[model samples]
Target: MEVLVSEVVGRGTVLAGRYRVLSPVVSDLAGASAWQATDQILDRPVRVRILEHGAVAPALDAARRAALVTDARLVRVLDVGTHEGYGYVVSEQLVGQSLARLVAQGPLTADQARAVVGEAASALEIARRRGVHHLALRPSVLHVSPDGRVLLGGLALDAALLGDSGGDARSTTRADAVGLVRLLYAALTGLWPADPRAPQTPGGETLPPAPIVNGSPVAPADLVPGVPNDLDTLCVVTLGPNEDGPHSPGELVRELEPWGEIRASVAETATLGEPMTAQFPPTGAAAPGGGIPVPADHDDQDTAPVTVQRQSVRTAFAQQDPPGANRPGTPPPATPTRATGLGPVPSDAETPPTGLPLITPPAYTQAAPPPPVVRRPVAQATAPPPPPEEETLEAFGFNDVIGAETAAPTTRRFDPTALILILVAVAVIIGVVLAFRALFASFDTGASSDTDPDPAPSASAPAVADPAPEPTAAETPVAPAGGPPVIASTTSIDPSDADGEHQEDVAKAYDGDPATFWYTQTYKRDDFAGFKDAVGYAITLTQKTTVSTVTLRTNSTGGNVEVRATDAANPTAGPVLASGAFGPETVLTLEPATETQSLVLWITQLPPAPEGGFRVEVTEIALS
Candidate 1:
């Protein structure tokens, strides 16, 4: 049942003036009606997810926020609005199958699992940074693009439509993070880790839920063989890692990035997708009555003189090995820009393939190796050229010689002793070459003693440690010598307002999310009405990182804020590092930079809110 205030719209029903519903009706996760529809306005296909009218606010806000995530692997949200009493979100349609349909057949190969889940994790992590959470990330919401790219759908709107995201920001973050690891487990073992007894899993119901014991999911390795130790540990540890808790999506991406397309899965191609070219062949493929011209009898058809017959494109590609793919130390051959030997089509390939039209490819010539230059005797004016049969030894030997031709036998041109001198000179030259070769052979055999490989290192040898894995580029600053502050956590502080609950929201300001914000309590006056001097939030860094500047992006302009170096999550007092009035963006600089584990952002004065009270909403906070 749709949230239609009027009559139910079936197939071919137009909604929101342009979308013509094509899918009859489908229900899942959100208790919503989903349809495949054609956008008459754009003249293209689109996916429309329709929910009840009550979910309009959250779903619309979530869709708008999710639209700000600019990753190619994320499905684009085209429209979000109300039609009649129903709220709907329209997104781009995918031509390829979803991971649900793919996994329905069988478990994916390890490479496919990693790539699909890895790319999904990457996109969701990017979405998380934008203050949008796909609390419902799972196989069904993940799709394979036509080019094999795995894309994530329903970034924020899914959870909104499902009504599963009423938790605070921290809980929502953890839910999304844990959801990513669970997806990895499901992709690997074909068993979903989310509790089976729950009404629904993230991204809706798909695979059979994993077996549970004592409130915990079973490890994937217990069911699957050859699952890598690292991946297995990643899946299991997140269920319970350490005191630090479940792993975040950023953490998952670090582990998953290296194994991209780790192994080939071409054997599952038929189950994965239909060969796109077979359904619609290339241009000129369906010519009538042998219309394609045969280049065999053409004058320029002789590409190059060759002793061997040329193979068809298919046969040549089958034999071509990837560089360093097979035997080691063998040099790779040159790959051609275009395939050759398509001239008249082979005698064995005259018939078109069944159901597929033959594509008569354009004719092209292959480059040939150049002939070697040779020195030959020149014919004299008085003499005829030497007979072709006795011409010269140039064709048979690697030697070059010059001489003149004559009509008759001439008197000896030089003394016979000259030949003897020439022989002596050749012998001396050969002896010198042999002597150098013997010398180099002695050097090659004799040079080894400085650093012996067999001996173990002494106890005093300096320890060599493995390099730490590099985090994704977004998390780390570009130049670390004196760069951005690496913040660890945040909390709001208001000693005067004892009942004020702001812990969950202090994080939103500096969370790298552009949509969320941290705001102060509304006061009747522009300044706190004869209350405490200020109310603000504090930032705890990963370590004692230096800070040269603090930047903020806020919805409320002209409000006053101060930066303070402090150790308190709930600071009562601290030394001011910098102070300034807020604009659309505000930057506060500290001379010579300060190194510390925690810093505070104290808001003293508030800007007037649109309705009545004075308040401030800081969208983002940055350190550099």
Candidate 2:
């Protein structure tokens, strides 16, 4: 039902009796135009939005909703009417620039962006609670008044009314939250991260989508490097495909208010020179032997060797000195440059021209040196000497007085001491095993004594006695040994007896499938009703039978309930047999109790669901 107009209205046109167009401000490709006009009746300035022919109904509906929101961050909607062949809405003229113009100049600082978006979130929360959604929110529609108030425009109202939202109220709210976050990101980075499903802005200029990693969009801090981590996470959770957090504007506002109040700079500081690897303490102005200068403190000078840097080692070795040299000013005896672990030292010609005292090797020594080095034979002695093991036993201080034949055979045989130790170990293991067997025998005797004694046989061992009276409902069933217990089939008890809808779903509780569950309808209060505190189901067997135990599996946590057995037509009329609080799963072993036809599971209390509802879900049930 779209209306087409043959003529276009221009400047100086009169509309709805007295309003006169003074100037055309902006005309969008979407067939919506804004004009600066004068209210001839009131003699004051006003802003007007001209809508295409068939758009009048939705435009007026949105204008009415937008008019109810009174916030400094939102533009004020005044009136809605049509003149000639066109429809339009009027509002107070705002004196400021659009968010697009502000961003075009340059990106806003982090604090500025926070303040702006925080204000927008507060305004959006108001509209959200009233069920009004701005699905067409974009930078071009967000204006900042001259007095520093944020004004969000409503180019989205018409689009939402036209059924272009493609989603429900909750989904539209999600989109609006995402849109605000996108605007914040654009303000902070000067780049728009568009959503493909969102409506196009007035101009038709397109923006690239945010970068995706794995399956989700990358965080803002990763893209720009200086965005605060908290802000980045907020944006990702609100706008990314995997988002499952805070789906409303109020929740978003709570997360952003603290960020706006923070005053610290978020920009990363730059390093002017080469990247730092490691830093060494600065050297003093002077040193002995022209080596790296050492600190003047007496304690540090004495301990310098332990804390000495590698740079000092090279300079120290270059100036040769004897093992125990004197202080810097004192002369010492001539000494050769010993072969330090750092290889050969420089010759006198290679030394610096500066005349300085010779270096004294510090007394702090490392680990003991290896065995004296042996120079290889000059004629290429490739054949290695026999191993040290081949030497005679005397080389290792072993006895040598005995004859060679006896000594050689004795040394080759196993030691008598090791043989004795192995025999002792075997004896110990046998003793331990025998002790374990003895202990097991004692335990078996104790267990046999604790078991019930078998019924004594009649002294005469004659004819069988008369048959006992038939068991009645008062008698409990005796379970046979070495057999699995029988399970009973379950059915949904009076569903209408509880909160109204989905009562038939309770049958799933005994379906034996964890994937399917029975749930109670959500109630305003935790208790199901004023008269009764519980809701439940019944399990009935084909014939009268005994149930030794029952198990209930619930997906929820924290609630009290009772299980009972009854022969009456209704299970709730039975006497309680077991009672306890609920967990992931509950198992109750019934004590000696009367036989019954039906079992009842009644929930006497309730807990809140994760999202502000009160209900209970049971996944499966078992009886033994």
Candidate 3:
């Protein structure tokens, strides 16, 4: 391994004459290099790890032991050999996406997340039982193959290459247990809740760092809404600063078995080299429209109209099985097995030839009943006569009188409806009067205020000139007070950035264009989860000037922002010029600030963004 040189290993460089390197996957990794290669004989892509300076004995031994494990969840090791004084181990290249890449896009569903993590835990448990541990497990090591199989790569070999040791097997196993939970945390929230001091494997940052407050990782549910309570509790308790997690991987397996079962069953019928989503082809009624269910307003274009046929009313609540659930592409039910002493009878089996009364359909005992029974009475068979003309008078309250059909048969009865009408009319008139009074009262009040009599100025004083009309909103100038503050340049300051925080677009903030502005990196929490206290822009004025106010027009509002007087690239806590929340129009008044050529716009807290997480956007800045 010491003799291996960097120049000898690279793209198109063959090792041991059996594996051909395609490209470098990870470079300068822990005194070693990993390459994506192909197996010459098998004509398949394989990963080859070349050690430039390390004891190959340990790595080779570890890889050999890992190769013996039969767990399907573990990536299979194909070959390990020395080529040109370089030690290399060949592994089957994963066809699907790495956990990091998938998570970088977005989070997985609860079931998918749990299922994948559970399988990873189970795989680690298998390796632990065989006295092997992968202390360097990270997001990149775990993968979901195209066929929907969960596979863990690197196994014990990753630890060996990195020279990672836990002093004993138990310690190493414990580290792996924690690693599995971390993977689970990432799957659910797309955040890593690891110790800030520890260095993560390359490509692990596909998920952002989890928000940490007071030296402990924040709860998962706190970052992503709708996280299951059980999952949230488990993550908080396990990945907390205390590190009180499962003692063994088996514990994780049992707890996650419920979620893993669904994914595991899905994997059984997965087709090779097909995307994982293809494994979940539409089922039941969804099969009719080519894996899409019919919408409420399908319009019969993509979906075929279904018509159900009924043979008899007895089928409605019959004890017999539903006739194979008449659906598109539905398979017919298998024939029921005959009763045999060797096995139990099928549930849908027909009655035996002996014709026992218990199971057989009963025979018709009485003849078919007569059918014709009309709505007309069973005895009458003819329509009833219409009501008499005198009854109609009762309808209008003219016929029936209270005492003694009256002293005179010719006397007419008074109707109660007439009294009700009179009362309603009176109420309507009173409501109209009250409404008019209120309306007149409001008019009088307005007139008194608008035309309040100024004390009559006798001819003793000259009449005062009429006051000039106030300007309307439309007539007000929309431009800045002193015109746009000339900004010479700007720079971004974000401690959380591993490479650069959109540095190329820093000028957009002061470009004098509202539509184009600079944006800060999205974070898991409003306070950046303690990753950093603040992030914003540092502006350099075209010339030093004493400005009393600094106004910012931003894409959003509600952020803790401050402006400090400084000319340094990275501003320090100095004399503050202005400070306030980010706004569509945030105006901050300077209090006795000194003249300075440079200024810093720092935002300590951010408001919620339409996208999940918190962010800041500054479109333009002005100084006066």
Tens-place lDDT digits, model 2, residues 1-624: 123432455677778877787776654436666778888999988887887744567667777777765555677777777776577888877555566656555455555576677767767777766567777767766766544556777834656444564378878787777878888877665567777665555463333445667555577676554566667887777667776656776676656642222121212332211111211122223346743223222223222112101111112223334456563334564554454565445456433344445443453144355444343332454444434553354355443343434333223455699889999999779666666654454334222222436432543332123222334443447764333334455544432332222455756877668989887655435665332345666666655667777787887776677788863246577567887766688886666554555677777776666666466778887777
lDDT leaderboard ranking: 3, 1, 2
Error of 2 at 363 (Å): 99
Scored by Cα lDDT, where does model 3 land?
Answer: 0.64
Cα lDDT of model 1 by residue, 327-430, tens digit: 32234433323343534434344444442444444443334534444444444335455455445544555225333333243445767798999999997786
Model 3, 1-624: lDDT tens digits are 233365677767877777888766643356666777878888877778886667677888788877765566788888887877778888776555667766655565555677788778877777676577778767877777655677788888877777765567666666887788888888776677775655655542356678788887788777666566767887787777775768678677655543322222233332333223213211113225432222122123213221211111111123223455533223554444444433334454354334532332122223354444322222442324324553454456643342332212244478899899999999779666666654454433222224546633553442234322334454455863343347788788754432235676788877788999888767556876554667767888777766778888888868688888874455666866667887789898888755677788778899778767688887887887
All-Cα superposition RMSD per candidate: 30.5, 33.8, 26.6
lDDT of 3 at 251: 70
Q: Who wins the lDDT comparison?
A: 3
Q: Total backbone clashes of model 3?
A: 0
Off by over 4 Å in 2: 1-8, 161-167, 202-217, 259-624
Quote the lDDT for 140 in model 2. Answer: 69
Global lDDT of each candidate: 0.63, 0.59, 0.64
Each prediction's number of clashing residue pairs: 0, 0, 0
Count steric clashes of candidate 1.
0
The better candidate by lDDT, 1 or 3, is: 3
